[model samples]
Target: MWNGDGTVEVYGFRVFYSEVDCVRRIFEKYPETATNIRPKNQMVKNAYMNNLLDLIDIICLAPQELTEEELRNAESQLLELVEVGFKLDWLKNKLEELCVKKKKMEARGARMRELDGLIMEQRRVLWELETELKNEENEAVSDSARLGFEDVV
Candidate 1:
């Protein structure tokens, strides 16, 4: 419904002049028949369908705009809109970014596993060296005791 100012309410969402001009054309085509709301509503829907990408751009690509919560809201809207057959041209870019991030995380995980294996091997080698040193000390003490006993005899 035309609000008599410069806006039309379409499906509970208000469409303003700044956002789209197609709905305004419907007003111009049927200026005197505001009472006949069906045509206007249909035209509003057509306008929305034609400008779906523009809506996505506002919700997803607005510059320096939308807070974290707002971004989440936009994400929800985008998902809903896509379910309704809305297509986004920039989705390929987002997919590429996510793939690159996944690769980086996998590389980091591999590096961590390698470091852990090296640390375990180093600890094992150190324990073996300590055991050998103790064995050598015990042998030296036993040999010295045998020499003392022989001298005593």
Candidate 2:
């Protein structure tokens, strides 16, 4: 356990091997034997619950800042929570709210992208018109100079 050699079946958050190794090192350094601790599975479930709550709070705080993928992930996790007997009315309401928000976000994103494309096309057209006007002006000046020179000759 101290060497972090065995494959750990992580229950709550996704963790890398390096983090597991660090945790192992910490435990090796500071070994505290607590009396009457909860069972391993119960501890894992509590940790999972805490992590999920934290994620929900974060999503509630800044739902707009999250990307579509992130929102989907949260929704799926919420569903998982429901499957695990966490059937709260607020959770269902939050799930519905998140669905609506995701749809709105997608629609807004599509519209914004469309507007950006239109703006780019308009700028391109404007550049071409300005170039054409400058070319015409230069040609007119050259033609006038030529006519003046011929009259003088």
Per-model TM-score versus the true fold: 0.39, 0.49
Per-residue error (Å), model 1, residue 29 = 32
lDDT of 1 by residue, 9-43 (tens): 64433677565565455345534313322334555
Residue-pair clashes per candidate, as listed? 0, 0
Q: CA shift at 104, candidate 2, in angstroms? A: 2.2
Judged by whole-model lDDT over C-alpha atoms, candidate 1 comes out at 0.55
Model 2 Cα lDDT, one tens digit per residue, 1-153: 222543343333233454555434423543331122233465465454554555556567555777777766777777665555554445557667876887887899899999999999999999999999999999998887745666888
Error of 2 at 17 (Å): 30
Window of ten residues with lowest summed lDDT in model 2:
30-39
Tell me the spans in candidate 1 whose CA falls farther than 4 Å from its real position: 1-91, 144-146, 149-152
Which ten residues in a row are the worst by lDDT in model 1? 30-39
